[model samples]
Target: MSPDQFHDRMWEILQDINKNEFHAVAAKPPTDKAIANLATSTGIALPKDFLAFSQKTNALCIMAREELWPEAKLFDVGPAWTFHRGLVILGIEAEDLPEWANIQNAYESLVELYELTDVLPLLKIMGDGNHYWGVKQDGTFVEVFDGEATTLECSFIDTYATEIKELIQRQKDMCELITKRNKKQH
Candidate 1:
């Protein structure tokens, strides 16, 4: 699916989840200025598809209990750095950088990695903020686990479409389980 299709379908899924299951926060679209600021601060060029995604919805937060995977939570441009921080920390250790150094050094490492790999931190995967769902420079999605980037099986839109569908199915399963228990109780 294209970015627009993904955006529309994601909103539809969120609306259904909001009406049926737990609360899932869908933030407002971000302004161009906001996106520009993020790019400047991070020193990484944001891909067009990702910029479009940000333009459609700034963030999507799933409640801890409501997450499809134990590690599924997405953030928008503003809070995206929260996930990047994890990457920085991971790089400090994974790359075996000495613990005693200027913090700026760590940040520089992250910027360089992003630039060299063409990967941008897009969302936090785990509620605890350890992992991230990063988008590649080519519009494909990747999972950033402990600062290591691995391409996912599909593109960004397909990945999200799959996620939303799974979330809806999980909601249905939970509802059925609840009704079945209630029937037995009565």
Candidate 2:
């Protein structure tokens, strides 16, 4: 699935789950100039599709700010939210280092470990402690778990959509089970 199509489907699922009460918390998509600046500042030649995705809309920060999936403890939204703010928080182009020591340290480690010049971090698996979904310069999708990189089965955009749909279904199943158990108790 294309990035836009994936996002549209996710929104549909989220809306159905929340009874259309939840709204997007992300601001408009970042401008092309902003995306280019982010690439230059981070010293990574980001994938064109990734830039296209970012331009479509900010990553899912709404779920982070709000407890969209209260029962789904497996869904950690922190990384997704924070990663979207990477350029701002990391101060990639700043003359001096970022004031936040931890942020600076983590940024350096990521840049060095991944040699971000060759691979760009696309999305972080927030719920799964210290894992990331990234894209290589050659357009291959990679999963970084515990700092080890593994190539994904297919393109990042399509795989991301498929995984997200499955995850949502899992959460829905869990919710149904919870509801049935609660009804029985009553």
Candidate 3:
């Protein structure tokens, strides 16, 4: 089917998921089974609505497709974000999935982004690509040609692992300071 055809059906299914009749997760609005059945039935490799729906609801997730995948729309919930000019959904995955995690990419991206707000000393990206992969170049966004979730893993686990940790600790400390100060005033 054409991209337009893909998008049209996608829109309908997304409306359903958002409307509460369908969900992506068994426990929540976007039930996994519902999403999978729809996607498979539609003949689309993956559901386009997953990203659109996520963008609409600000749904945080760590989705795995053909391995570990974290699409761009899902990963945008980060500080110092570098979006591709027109590429809506860039895919990647992160390794270290915490053994047992739910909505793995969403949780990872949310915490990962928040952690970087103040703690990242800096990122020096030096790579050759049209997208964010390999080494992060100044104007590039983290991207993956295949297995999107793996890209997330590489960014955080390989190149930026150290920075990711520092950012988390920094956020924790900042929160503690704020809490302490707030308690004193009250």
For candidate 1, report its TM-score: 0.52
Distance (Å) between predicted and true CA of 54, model 3?
16
Show where candidate 3 strays beyond 4 Å.
Answer: 1-156
lDDT of 2 by residue, 3-120 (tens): 6765565455444334332233333565556556766655556555445544554444322223323423454343243222111111222233323312223335566765544445
Local error of candidate 3 at residue 90 (angstroms):
6.1
What's the candidate order when arranged by decreasing TM-score? Answer: 2, 1, 3
Evaluate residue 88 in candidate 3 and report its C-alpha lDDT on the 0 to 100 scale: 16
lDDT digits (tens) for residues 31-141 of candidate 1: 566556555655556556555655654455444243422232454332332222111111111122233221223334445655334555555432233355556556667
Candidate 2: give its CA RMSD in angstroms: 7.7
lDDT of 1 at 184: 100
TM-score per prediction, in order, is 0.52, 0.56, 0.22
Local accuracy by lDDT, each model: 0.48, 0.48, 0.29
Q: Which stretches of candidate 2 lie over 4 Å from their true place?
A: 1-25, 61-68, 71-118, 180-186
